[model samples]
Target chain A: DAGITQSPRHKVTETGTPVTLRCHQTENHRYMYWYRQDPGHGLRLIHYSYGVKDTDKGEVSDGYSVSRSKTEDFLLTLESATSSQTSVYFCATSTGITLQETQYFGPGTRLLVL
Target chain B: ELKVEQNPLFLSMQEGKNYTIYCNYSTTSDRLYWYRQDPGKSLESLFVLLSNGAVKQEGRLMASLDTKARLSTLHITAAVHDLSATYFCAVDSWETSGSRLTFGEGTQLTVNP
Candidate 1:
């Protein structure tokens, strides 16, 4: 898991409900990312944070938002969950000292929207 | 936008056989990564190819990158049953500030004894 942990490993929620997933890292990496995995789409980045309070959208950022208030924690929020958003979410961290640094992933959280 | 495509989406091989998985990307990027994921488990980084001819090997797996052609290959030698897993290739997006990775649809492999 590379010292990264995602809370609520498995969750069952209803449509239109708000949900927040938390990612915490003990390695103090400078870069954090949120990705979602589906059956045929592989993994798509939702958002990424370079530092505290600095975040940017990825290719699939719609319907999702992210916040990084602390160096060790990154949060992904869904304002109103939809069935299409049901997927396995992964949190990854990397050392941003170099551009080629490898990203380490955490145990994924499985979200199911009913 | 960078698009990555992997061939042989599903593979079934016998133990002791050799196989290769190919990844092709649409755009240019010098940095490429390979990852393996087991059933119901998180993704594990396998190789990082940072140059045009970068090649990395671990255990029975070897990965190579050709940035000119935007192609990467993961070769398995004397495959074992334990090597069964889904493999993914991700290309670094230089157009983005965060070095976002664009991943290919994973290749699912099954090694039969």
Candidate 2:
């Protein structure tokens, strides 16, 4: 298993409040991804960083943002939490010359917006 | 747009039975991945198939990919209670070096005694 950890394992915040989740890795993987898992929706990509400061929006990037200033950390922030945004967030890391490599995941962060 | 779909969204099987889960993708891709997730837990990767007719097996589970049909299958042989979990399949294109994976809606499996 890759050494990936997500801080604030669980959180509950009111709607309209700003929230941030942190994903830290010790494997020094070049690729980091953030995804939100909802019931019946599977895992939707939020944002991903290919390298330090090189990131891109994913399928579900409308309400989220991410940053990767260092090789081992990627952060996902919600500007204003909404009830629909409540879901389990996961962080994954993969490293290889190609994207075909298998991705390793962190435990997960459960968030609830009331 | 890429879409990955899994069939039998929910399955309940008795222990020692056999079942197969199917995954289909909308577009062409270079690889497919199978992952298992326990309730409230993170995903654990099970297989990575890169080409058509590629097959891999671990324990009681076997996975095969048919790129021509854009389909993948995960077969459980003699299921056990401990095999209960949600399984997901993800596909990725071959265009970029760090392309993201588009995941399918997971298939939740429950193994009963």
Candidate 3:
């Protein structure tokens, strides 16, 4: 509802297959983040982008890659999906580095690899 | 690397009870944030504390931060059933990028009538 949208709300892919999740925002926020939520691990940041084409790794960046070719679009790709990568993914965007600034989150995309 | 920890990983209380959740970080941070999440849902922002002794409250929940001690607390007053959910605290390190946040494991609270 905050202008951030995640595509493929739910997807089931076989192990060893490639998967790509899309996050689009209309807010023109400079910072974008991709996080994964698991049952016991809470929310873990996978990757984040500060500006278009400028991205960095997070605490849990293994096995995931992110691309922000444009201001409004960020893509997360799983080269070869594994069962351990199954979780709900969330995308968030904000204006700048100030933590006090609120971040807008998208509805989350659930992925299951079997 | 900064680590954030939350106390009483899980909590259960009845209606109208008062309780507080604690968050401790390993390193000094100028900014701390509190977030709530329901089962199978994304995080919802609760409070953001920017400096030492910063306090903010909304409805029945109150939050405070002590940057000097590297700690933050979320207190619930006269809790209700609707307040049941998981709460998390994150720290933004001074050297780290502004978009990066190190999150605590989270405190799951269950409120019953």
Candidate 4:
């Protein structure tokens, strides 16, 4: 509904392998965020980008990295996959015009680490 | 650090019953949000409370925020099967630059007929 799409909707990778998930948005939102959802933990932010080339670490950024080179694209990469990294990853975008605006979420990507 | 907690991690309610989900936070924040997610689906924003004593309602769901108490509540009026889903409350970290949200554990609702 927010013109957001995530690539590789589902993926399975072996431990120690590299994995990258892509989030693309057509709304040209200024703020883009990556989050991981796990049982009993709700949704935890992995990383977020405020503008092109501007990024910051979130509460759970240990095993993940993010980059945004354009307003419409944000990428999250797991340098080396691990079993603990298996979770549903979601991409969200907000206009950033005001802090009160609600974020719009993408369909989400489910990653499995074997 | 900011912490958010939601009570009754799991709830089961009968159709047409009324209930309330409570959210409590550890720090002071003016912005609070409520979201709903179906099983295996992404979250959908339901309400955004921006200030103290803010109240918003849509359909059968109503959300209120009390900045003084650092609490928020989501009330359901005459719930239905379609309302069965996991509800999450997120608090905006005012100290953060990007409006980072600290989320609660979430409350899973099961509405049966």
Judged by DockQ, which candidate is best?
A: 4
DockQ of each: 0.76, 0.68, 0.63, 0.81
Docking class of 1: medium
Instruction: For candidate 3, write residues B69-107 as lDDT tens digits.
Output: 888999999999999999998887543455567889899
- Residue pairs with clashing backbones, model 2: none
lDDT of 1 by residue, A1-114 (tens): 559999989999999999999999999998899999999989999999988999999999999999999999999999999999999999999986785578999999999999
Which pairs clash (backbone N, Cα, C closer than 3 Å) in model 1?
none
lDDT digits (tens) for residues B17-93 of candidate 1: 99999999999899999999999999999998999899999999999999999999999999999999999999998
Task: Write out the backbone clash pairs for model 4.
Answer: none
lDDT of 2 by residue, A1-114 (tens): 799999899999999999999999999899999999998888988889889999988889998989899999999999999999999999999985653479999999999999
TM-score quality measure for candidate 1: 0.98
Candidate 3 lDDT score at position A93: 88
Categorize the docking of model 2. medium
Q: What is the full ranking by TM-score, best candidate first? A: 4, 1, 2, 3
Worst 10 residues of 4 chain B by lDDT: B93-102
Ranking by lDDT: 4, 1, 2, 3
lDDT of 3 by residue, A41-82 (tens): 767889999889989998899999999999999999999999
Q: In DockQ, how does model 3 score against the reference complex?
A: 0.63
Q: Lowest-scoring 10 consecutive residues by lDDT in candidate 1 chain A? A: A94-103
